[model samples]
Target chain A: MTTPSNKLPARAIIREVGLRDGLQSIATILSTAHKHTWIRAAYAAGQREIEVGSFVPARLLPQLADTAELVAYARTFPDLFVSVLVPNLRGAEDAIAANADLMIVPLSASHAHSLANLRKTPEDVVAEVARIRAARDAAGSRILIEGGVGTAFGCTLQGQVEKREVLRLMQALLDAGADRVSMADTVGYADPAMVRDLFEDALRIAGDRFWCGHFHDTRGLGLANVYAALEVGVTRFDACLAGIGGCPHAPGASGNVATEDLAYMLGSMGIQTGIDVQQLLALRAQAAQWLAGETLHGSLWQAGLPKTFTAAAAVAA
Target chain B: MTTPSNKLPARAIIREVGLRDGLQSIATILSTAHKHTWIRAAYAAGQREIEVGSFVPARLLPQLADTAELVAYARTFPDLFVSVLVPNLRGAEDAIAANADLMIVPLSASHAHSLANLRKTPEDVVAEVARIRAARDAAGSRILIEGGVGTAFGCTLQGQVEKREVLRLMQALLDAGADRVSMADTVGYADPAMVRDLFEDALRIAGDRFWCGHFHDTRGLGLANVYAALEVGVTRFDACLAGIGGCPHAPGASGNVATEDLAYMLGSMGIQTGIDVQQLLALRAQAAQWLAGETLHGSLWQAGLPKTFTAAAAVAA
Candidate 1:
């Protein structure tokens, strides 16, 4: 019960995945201008890190076909760290060509998910990360590489993924020359204790090279799990604006934790996440208009900020 | 990341506030039969504790006029601990007569809220708790007394509530002979650091006498605040099924954290809350149908459980 004077360090980074994760799952396709507005607004709200879009083939994901354009637009902000999801070496090339701050190569930990979705074994994806790293060095690109192990917990395709297997793949990714590695509860199977145990172990092996915690709010434990990771000194997270993504492969699964809500949680804890929650809610309203038919999720947007919120003064104090 | 073989002790208690908190706030007045059905189903779902109804005047809250009947029904379950909210001594008498397991007298820490909502000063409420305790002793009743300090963080009417004042009020309740005390972020202005600081101090003062953490998801930091409290060793929490019961005075405020969501969080974290989340979801479905126009808040209901979920089996493994 002793009051610890020093605030808990801000280890969590909420990367706004609204434009990519949110837009891709919904039936509606936002105009490129709307995407630009979202990116601008999110950055203005103190979101320095953002996954602006994905670098998949244009025809495969029409919702994100303007990723190249969005990437260019996001790069306009001086300190903003713009990232793009790259599925393969070709996508990596596109990301490198666009000069994204970071390019994440997602590898599903579930064998069934890897085979069915990516058409490659988990090890094969690690091999691709090696090739992508080689290509980046060959092309003299400075963009960072993040090997994201999706479904690191259990998976919709293959239930009960072994933690040992996830840890091995994570190590393999690092060994294969990945600049950083992240574990994701891609199907949202993680709970707080699991997050604490796994992240603590992963950090022991990967050190500061273990980058972010990606959790889906599919089963409502997203923020709880993130808090556990924070307790264990892992900072940086992947979140969608308005909690907008849904798993296409997993039936009845929802999106990542809402970025606005996550920001509010951090800001309330007196942790410096640098994101303005009010501005995030305003941005959500704007995004809602563009995504009229899409189901947007989040609690803070509907509730608004509490009267006692003095973020400007609190930060100054 | 050493996996600690020592299992986390089960500490969560979902104090169901639907009958009093949920029904009183909403326009719907469920039939007595429906209330009985809810109590029965909630108990069946492993919900050992329930706030069946309030003991306010029927004229003030006709929705809870069936409080006596509901309490009687709840007592039918041997292990179920039935609680009731009593605003003053008169209500306390009714609660004692019903042989309720617990009687919570809510006292707002915010002076403005105390005056406007409860028509009493903070000290006046403490005096009332003394009176209630005296009456209980005189009547030879063994009902547990709980002093719930609401608006402990901030209030809509009075913007910033000092931490010293909240702690003083909490100590006042204990001195006034209340069996237990708990803090509430009634206006949802709490951040994790603030929660940690206050709960830590309060726990030092109240020791094991501090019982529950009541948080509103109004600003979307409800789950995060709960986590902070957990870190400080709080286990029991107050949540509404479907996140119902917002303050009528606070226009944009949301309800308590969804009970089913909270249960899922605890269950997933390897903490035994004893409540079945799937059964809670089913109860939510019935509650939704009964309270059709009411805005229900929860994530697990919309997206359902994750594919990785194997009930208690996953956690056991």
Candidate 2:
């Protein structure tokens, strides 16, 4: 294994995923108006990329029932890179219809997790990716397709997911015509060492096509794992506002890394993310009010930004 | 800058500083009996180094008034490395009298913080260390002296503490007869990149004499900062159980990194801490009950160890 480079990227992207990932796992069903406000506030806080919601059936996930509306609302922002989660070709079709910039297809690398969570084998998901690509191409749409491999580290049900297996699925997704690929520690099983080891290889394999790193803060290693991936030149990450999400299968697990906290970390390191953390914290306060009764996570909300924290723009200047 | 070494040390130390740092700032004043239980539980959970309490006047800090009694109690465990915090020569005398393994003399790198917190300038603290060393030598005590520079990253009261000033203070402490030196981000201002840069320089200057890294999780970068230090080959860190400390001056800042969480991070990285994180969690549960109504911090308590986590001993084996 090579030593981790201390050099961080000059800029990075923190794709806000709270609308889909954070809202889906919670009990509250946020209204389309609330989601529209959330998207507006997030954009105001300088978030360029946002996964607004997922296009699953309303019966299965009523919390995300307004995915189409939210996508249309987010698309109104001229420079916003709007995305949505697509479970299959049908969801991808809806995303395209809503004119989303991208649609993410999640595949679980853990065989048991794939069956339990997605109701399909890993290979079956790859085939579905191929079908979705064909459909997108046939529609002559400009929407990008990102195959995000979850359980890339391990799974609660499967205990350990082999690194080789994760890499193989990522390659298969690319071969199946995925425009981009990303990895997710869906169950929060990833440590910095594991992230460094796997993400290094992923970068070698996919290079610039390795789109993002998604990490859950369940065991509190999310930011550290992001730091590890950052060391290996993975610049984009997925985070939830106030860290609101959890795997239903992993009891008591927390959400992804907090968007405000991640922004603070990157800014403090002189890595530009074009985010205003104070503005993000204000949005988080609004989110807490909307998602009352839910356990909100993150430290920056309490402590505020440090006296030494420089804004990303200031750092760049 | 050099690349960060991915090769973590085979073994590292997590020195528990809860009894001293945690109790001093909180309203809850744990009884001597509770402290005894805490020390016993921590030792049972495989923590060897512990700072039982500080040697300040009881009227000033009634919480840590039982420092001498606690030191005597902790000495019963022949293998335990017991330490205490001392403010000046008088406290060092008390530590030497108590036959403590070591005494940490804290020197603030920020002049404003130094005057406000300790009522002594940085140079004054260095001179005090010299007097303490003389006293220790005169008493022929085997107790070691560690000069810890706090606010080494930056200070809330003084904004930014210069790197040259911090390095100069560290060197001054050593020249004043300190047996070892360490750095602390007293107000939780440190980021991982700052940690890597400063700690790499510290390691170069002090080598093995650089005893520890003390970080506060006030802004959520504590564990990530620890990971950066680990990459730079520093193997010792100071943590509070359940993350039960905060700065009196910085109102919203949280405590040091949580002991159980830090243990979990190290074990996950295949570093042998000799700590059973499950046992540490149980102790944390007890600590929570003992200090009820006080806000505690950390993530591992909510989500237990991951399915993929191997015990440090197993990893070493």
Native-referenced DockQ of model 2: 0.60
| Pairs of residues clashing in candidate 1 | A11-A235, A12-A236, A13-A236, A268-B191
lDDT of 2 by residue, B147-265 (tens): 99999999988789999999999999999999999999999999899998999889889988999999999988899999988988898999999998877766666788999999999
Residue pairs in collision within model 2: none
Measured against the true structure, the TM-scores of the candidates, in listed sequence, are 0.95, 0.97
Taken over the whole model, the C-alpha lDDT of each candidate is 0.84, 0.91
lDDT (Cα, tens digit) per residue for candidate 1, span B156-212: 888889999999999999999999999988878887778878998998899889989
Which candidate comes out best when scored by lDDT? 2
lDDT accuracy of residue A118 in candidate 2: 90
Q: DockQ values for all predictions?
A: 0.50, 0.60
Model 2, position B88: C-alpha lDDT score: 97
